[model samples]
Target chain A: MQPQRIAVVGAGAVGSYFGMRLAEAGHDVRFLMRRDYDAVKSGGLHLSSHLGDLSLEAATVERTPEALAAHGPVDWVLVGLKATAIPDIPKLVGPLLSEGTRVLAIMNGLSVDEEIAAELPAGTSLFGGLGFIGVIRGEPGQILHQEFGAINLGHHGDDPHELQRGVDLFAGSKVEIRPEASLLKARWEKLCWNIPFNGLCVIAGGVPVDQVIEDPPLYDAAHELIKEIVAAGNADLEAHGQSARIDGPRIAHLFLTQTLGMGAYRPSTVIDYNNGRPLELDAIFRQPVQRASQLGIGVPMMSMVASLVGKLGERVE
Target chain B: MQPQRIAVVGAGAVGSYFGMRLAEAGHDVRFLMRRDYDAVKSGGLHLSSHLGDLSLEAATVERTPEALAAHGPVDWVLVGLKATAIPDIPKLVGPLLSEGTRVLAIMNGLSVDEEIAAELPAGTSLFGGLGFIGVIRGEPGQILHQEFGAINLGHHGDDPHELQRGVDLFAGSKVEIRPEASLLKARWEKLCWNIPFNGLCVIAGGVPVDQVIEDPPLYDAAHELIKEIVAAGNADLEAHGQSARIDGPRIAHLFLTQTLGMGAYRPSTVIDYNNGRPLELDAIFRQPVQRASQLGIGVPMMSMVASLVGKLGERVE
Candidate 1:
């Protein structure tokens, strides 16, 4: 297979980690950073991961998409920006995409691809990916990989070959990549964990996963939240002519067991909230809740959590 | 009517304000304080209210219920301790109660009467009072009445005369005293406001009432929470062979409008949680939530809020 030229837009934690992985896999990877442009450009990118530590001494870096695209039309523009950054995507990444360039969003939350799709030029191929990794940007040019790292990838359109191509990008990497036929299903499945853990952690005032799980009532509430999200997600899937992909009890048990082994992890949203950064409320919370509402599903827990985190985000902003 | 003897146990804010009111009404009101005993004993009790300012020069104060009881069996023991202090009530106020001495709990939350009932002697007529007042202890011996000052009093057993006697204590005072047939109904109604504002305020990191209301989403969540609490309350009332008295929309509108006029008020639970004091979780949050669960009423919003606030309270304690 020919090595693909990839532009990593918004190279923060998720972007830099995956971009480095792709770079290590011998792909021509370039990073587009905003605030940490100077630091990343000077020092390159570093990843301290459970799998293994990685350092890139001389990697392609850019301050903007225009700068990234100035060289040539890249094969793929891998977006790693927080979902809160969705509004700026069309204008920022419009200049970066050619007709055949596929934009893969390695971001968390539902309806993210749709939001990005609304802004992109018509016929711009989009692939949605949910990164189930506990990765954080410790500092400029530094990424801390806490625990589980996996990517569930699926093309927005029904193109098996296209999905396979996206999957092949991470063929030999240690990071697990699962290709799915339905991106929406994948998104909903991921929300089974995100909605409860991320939402509750922030709602509980930025406590760790262990603390939230250890408290009996809170743990019970977490399960209740997960159940509500699953119900809503299934309702949404049914609306979209798809079957339920998330099993509440099974998924909740899996999350609890897995999270227990992951140690005391502070979710991305919690970290974002505590650091006074913009939360990915629209993508991770509001969009999914709105979709669930449109489908006539009641997600009171999610709605409340969304309201709380959204308000907290506003206060900080 | 003869002036009755009253013991104001746990005279923090609600106790001091009402105790002073009864005293001003020419009743023999004695205060039993814990933390502010020295200051209050030295400076007496000061109440700054919308209706009028009150300064007591020679207030009868005691540090313990035994000391207060040493004078005699008081006609009324107005218990104003935080709901978290319920465990100490049986031990603290046990000696203060006699056959005819009625205990009026001016504290907040549900099943408070039951908790107190468990610890008190059999047939010790209990009157539960919900203080709808926005009074706070600004400092030792100082009570700042922010806005509305009303108390809804109801008897635990079938005794209208018992309830009226409790109401008659504040007959001529500025504090509006309302007599209800059912204390449980009143408790649940008060929770409609408490669960949303107090729970969310603390959950949102000690945000004020106005801030919670000003944010559109938070305001909506507050309304949703009130609706759930009303549903649960009605369910609880129905379980007790009573009909629903609390209208979700009407009561919610009343609370929102009244809160708007009250400016920014930091609720007692929020203050307690922020100041590292015990939250009235069992009575305020857990009891009602448990009642809802028992009746198979799905109060997802309340459950989540309860869990969040309950966890925060635990962390602080």
Candidate 2:
């Protein structure tokens, strides 16, 4: 495959990690950054990973999306901002999109691709990239990639070729990408982990994943949340005419069992909460909870987490 | 009321305040102290209240129940310890209990009187004293009374006169005591406030009652919790052959409205959590959540709070 040109928008930890990997694979990658723009422009971007360390001393840093677009439309624009910043997708991502430009949204939360797609030009190829890893943004221009560098790639757009393109971008990198036939199912699978871990971590006094896994009630609450979310996800899948149904109890057991080994992994939501930054409430909680409600699914754990996470988020403002 | 003989068990802040008052009013009130025994014995006890300041320089500090019994069985025994300490009820309150002695349980949570009664001798006159005040134990031997020192007193025994006897004990004191015909309803009424505020405060990152009131989802969650608890209470009351039933929406509105003026009021549970002390889980959340489950009521929010609070409680251990 020929080398690709990629523009990374909202290049936070996850975005920066993937874009850096893609760029290291000989793809021409440019980052549209703000907070870390100066640091990245001068010191360049660095990813300290368990698997390996990677750094770009002469990384390209574009101050604005307009500046990023001026370099010409990239093959793919990676929308890696927090779900809370999804609303700014149009202004930040719109300028970087050409008619053929595909998007690989590397953000957590449900219906984010749809949200980003709705705001951008119609029929644009939007691929949902759910990153399953422990990564955090450190002192400017640095990514602390703790473990599990894997991506669940699913296409939300009509272009079937977009899925292959999404997979190809990470083909030569150390990062493993698993392409899914159903984006909805992949997102829901991610929710099984995110809704419980992210929500419980913040709601249960901003503790880490191990705390949620260790505390029986919280651990039980986590499973209850997973059960509720899985059921809702299955119901929504059915409603959307997809034959993708999640097995609730099994998924709960799997995620919780996996979490037991996660040690003290702090989900990004807890990090955001402890830092008093805005949470991805709508994309992660409110949207899913609302969808569950619309489907007449009773999501008490989901609802509780949503409101509590919502309240926790408001503590910053 | 000729200066009654009173023994205060679990004399924390609330116990110290009321005991100091009774002692000031010319009654013989001895406190069975543990943590604050030496300080109280040396420096006496103090009550810094909004209504007025009160102190007892010569406060009686009994090291043990047997030591307390040496002064003879008091007319009334005030149990003001945290509900978590209720298992020691028999050992702590037994020495001070005579056939004629009336017991006043000044603790929070569901069926505390019943639990205490079960642990004590049968046919004993028991009273439930639900205190509505913002009081916290500060420095040893000190009581920080923020506002509203009122106790809803209700007889929980076969003796009809026990309520009046309980009322007369606090009659001359500055602390107001309102007698209720039904102890169950009164306790339920108190739960209307405690379940939501206490549970939500700790669960939502050790925030105050105001945050629970101010945040929309938390505010809504608080109401949802109140409704679940109130329904469970009503059902339990009916099952117990009581005619009392709580009007859910009205009570919810009243408590939430009341909380708006309670700026930054940290509930005792939140305080216990922040201090890493064992929470009054069995008395406050588990017992009630269990009772609700037994009644076949769906208490998602209540269950979530119970498990989270339970987990949060275990964090200290």
Candidate 3:
């Protein structure tokens, strides 16, 4: 496959790490840095992964999307910003997009691609990616990748050719890319883990995921949250005229078992909360909660969890 | 009303404060001190109340119920220990009770009188009191009473004369006594306030009642907890062949409104949780949750709150 030119937006842990991975795979990848802009600009971006370390030169780092756009139309625009930053999608991506540039929103929450798609020109190839990874932003210019860098890639548009390209972009990288048939389905599946762990870690007093697992009521809420997400997801899939239904019990059991092995690892939201940064509540909790409610699913714990997490944020705002 | 001889079992904030009030009213109030046994026995028991300050002599403080019982059978035994201490009632009160001695359980949580009465000799006069006040243990020998000091007295058995005698005991004190006609109904009413405030305070990260109110999701859980308690209480009343029902909507509104006025007051459970003392989970949360579940009501939030609060306790235990 030809090395494609790619631009990375919201280059936090997810974006920077993946972008650096694809860069090592020989893609022409450049990052849009904000908080780490100065550090990365001077020292370049670094990804410390157990899989292998990768480094990008200072020339590959840009402070603004307009500066990143100077290279002209790229083959793909990879969005790794928080769902909370979705509103900035248009202005941020507009200067970086070409008529043929495919946008991949590798975000945690639901409907991110749709939101990004709405911001772009019509017929702009778009897709979604859900990274199941344990990674966090270290100091400026570095991302510490602990484990699992697999992304479930699914196209939002009807272009099968572009979806394959989304997978092929990570071909030689350590990150495994599983191209999914349905973006909505994959997003909901990710939410089965995200909503509970992310929201609960913050709600359970900034504890790690394993602390939540050890705590029975929190564990119960986590199980219920997963079950509700699966139910809501399956209902959503059926509503979207899709045939496959995500299994609720299996997902609950699986997530609970998986969470027990998290071994006191804190989720991203808790990290964000501890650092006093804005959470990705809208995409992660609010959107999914709204969809579940609309589907007539009973989501009392999930709703309460969302509201409580939102309260934690609304205090400052 | 003539001065009555009374023994105060559990000289924490509620017990010591109210006991001191009754002592000032000329009642011969003797107290059983545990944690503060040495300090109180040496320096005497003190109540610093906004209403008025009262202090008891060293002679009035006893280290054990046996020592308290040594003064012959008291006319009244005020069981002010937490519901978590219910199991000890038999051993503690057994030495304090005489045939004519009536037990007034001024404790929080459900079915205290029943639990006490069951452990006592058959036909032991047992009644319950619910104190609506703001009080806390300040030091070894002192209790800080910040606000209201009122007791809602009700007989667990069918004894009108004993109930009035219970009321008359607090006749000259600052503590206003409102003798409720039904213990069950009064317990349920108190629960409308207790279930939400106490449980939520602990579950909301050991914050005050006011903080729980300000937090939307915690507040939502609080409101839902109150609603579930009201429904459960009403159901329990009906199941027990009582004609009257505790109004759910009214209780919810009244408690939520009243809670907002609490002004950062931390409930007892939160205090216990912070102090590493046992919470009154079995009586306050577990019993009510079980009863509610048995009544075919959906108490998801209430149930979860109970489990979470319980988890907060179970960690150390």
- lDDT, candidate 1, B145-254, per-residue tens: 88788898898873788887887778887778888888888888899889989989998887778877876667888888899999888888888988647777899999
lDDT of 3 at B1: 85
The residue-level lDDT of candidate 3 at B294 comes to 87
The candidate scoring highest on lDDT is 2
**Deviation from native of the Cα of residue A193 in model 1, angstroms:** 3.7
Question: For model 1, what is the C-alpha lDDT against the true structure?
Answer: 0.84
Candidate 1 residues A78-116, lDDT tens each?
998778889989767888888799899988889888888
What's the lDDT of the predicted structure labeled candidate 2? 0.86
Candidate 3 per-residue lDDT, tens place, A147-201, comes to: 6789989989535788888877788877899888888888898999988888777
Indicate which candidate wins on TM-score.
Answer: 1
Q: After superposition, how far is residue B239 of candidate 2 from its true place, in Å?
A: 15
Per-residue accuracy of model 2 over A1-317 as CA lDDT, tens digit each: 68888999988888899999888889999999989999988899998988789999999888999998899878888888888787788899889888788888887888887778788898888899889889888999999998688999999942457788788888888889998878988899899999999998877767888877886667777888888999899999999999868878888888899899999999988888888888888888999999999999988668878877887687765
* TM-score of the A chain in model 1: 0.95
Q: Flag regions of model 3 displaced more than 4 Å.
A: A4-105, A110-128, A134-150, A154-164, A171-193, A205-266, A270-283, A286-303, A310-317, B34-50, B53-59, B66-73, B118-122, B214-220, B241-244
The CA root-mean-square deviation of candidate 1, after full C-alpha superposition on the true structure, stands at 4.7
For candidate 2, give the docking quality class from DockQ: acceptable
Q: Which lDDT tens digits does candidate 3 get at residues B227-269? A: 7788888888888887767777887888788788879798888
Worst lDDT 10-window in candidate 1 chain B: B210-219
- For each candidate, the DockQ is 0.37, 0.34, 0.23
Best by DockQ: 1
